[model samples]
Target: MASSTTRPDVETAAPSARVAGRLLDSSAKLSYDPLTEVDWETPLDTDFHGASPEWSTLYGTSYWDELTEAQRKELTRHEAASVASTGIWFEMILQQLILRDVYAKDPGDDAVQWALTEIADECRHSIMFARGAKKLGAPAYRPRRVAVELGRAFKTLAFGEAAYAAILVAEEVLDVMQRDWMRDERVVPFVRTINNIHVVEESRHMKFARDETRKNLAKAGPVRRHIHAFVIAVAAYVIVTSMVNKGVYANAGLDPERALAAARSNEHHKAMMRSSCSGLMDFLASARLLTKPALAFYKRAHLI
Candidate 1:
């Protein structure tokens, strides 16, 4: 009788398995599609075409425009590399968040939705970079993925909440940077297009990161014992400093070490860096994680 009963239970399992398969399929549906969602065909306004002679006066458009065709092409080539790197960074950020959410075992549906949106954005950005390279007749090179070393570093060094906050601040800074470059008369149209797409999406991303970070910090125990938050904050500082160094200036054929030195020497970059770093620190202090010791450490590191 027991053996006979087992066959009926097995028969019952088949229908349940079918139902589970359908649920999995439904859940796999993508929340966003980059091709349909982005305004790829949007026309560039005339300013990007270097049409106005006076435009050369307000900005150093003459210096940019006076480059020989070959030089202009080389700049485009380098810009594409820069864009490729930016896209890779965005993809890494998305993957890191996904891994964190999984590890925390508190992955909400909302978080998954956000991840999917970011993935779509990253994919679109990758395509845009590739397209720019193609248009410029430059060899398309994929941005190297986050290395094993980086993963190991995160495992050992990361603080969840602080890292998230840093990401928020860095995104805010980059959003401003992209907006400025996109509106520059000397910037090429394709470059402006890439920047415009990023600016549109990242504005929302930055706001979400900031708002959600505050909400998360408020719910955290007032005691500053959270290891995750600490790691995140440190990661943010490392990344932001790296952005000006390896990320931006390096791609422009400028020496990053020298650029850092130059930024220290120049009032503008130094002032911008200081103000931005201050904003990041203020947020951490508000969350009670940026102790006097931490602030002093940042100052010593020249991160402030």
Candidate 2:
């Protein structure tokens, strides 16, 4: 009986093992040390934008057209810094989640090893984002108080598919914007390098997250699935909304009230978000995590 079960166990573990092993190999081949890779010694250049203008929250708003070129660049720089600050916050949350998820698991498993490697990558990323934000001459941009408390709660309680799926949503949203910023000549060189490093490494993390989400959900009953789906959707809404802080408008020398109103109604920015997240939305739908309740949250976040 034991012998008969051996093959089934091996078959079941093979896919996860293979994925983790490949990710480990990939990390070894192309991982970066941002400490040395980013040109930290160079003086910050005011001429370069911190991000692509089109990704700006106010990009298509009437207020955006009134800004001078320097003002526009300044605005984007602060916005980029705000985004990076939010990234640091979420990365901290995710590191704890991953650590918690792997606690008491077999240390020798490839999946466990891969999770640790991913944690190491995220630690470095948080540091890199902090430095980058400072270099952009932006102040610390923390999430709103409600979001902070919610993230604290989520990081403590989320597990399995709920945890992994939330991680995927954050990575996917940042991935799309960073992909554009990394290639745009208008973005500062060091910032571009940072984006490139993050994009390269986070790709593997996203793959692992997607795999983990599917695997975990496979074991969940219908009730659990629907419950986690709503949880993950709420998490996504918080993350997406927290990306650009409200203070960025004032920091960029814009009228905060006017900028906020314009940004709230910016159809172009909403469209960009929906377009960028289409693939992620499809993945959630395929996993059957896009319940009617979940879809409503995603729609409100402009991620659908």
lDDT of all predictions, in order shown?
Answer: 0.49, 0.95
Q: After superposition on all CA atoms, how large is the RMSD of candidate 2? A: 5.2
Q: Specify the poorest-scoring 10-residue window by lDDT in model 1.
A: 50-59
For model 1, what is the error of residue 91's alpha carbon versus the real structure, in angstroms, after optimal superposition?
3.2
Candidate 1 lDDT over 1-304, as tens digits, reads 0122222233344442333232223334422333544444655332332111121111233344445544444444454454445445544665566456446443444444554555555667667656654544334443334433453466444444554565675566556556665686666566666667677666555555565566567667745435545555455445444442233334434455654454445544444546545666676667676655556545543446
Model 2, residue 24: distance off in Å is: 0.5
What is the TM-score of candidate 2? Answer: 0.96
Off by over 4 Å in 1: 1-80, 83-87, 102-108, 127-152, 155-159, 222-230, 244-264, 275-282, 296-303
- Model 1, residue 287: distance off in Å is 2.6
lDDT of 1 at 39: 45
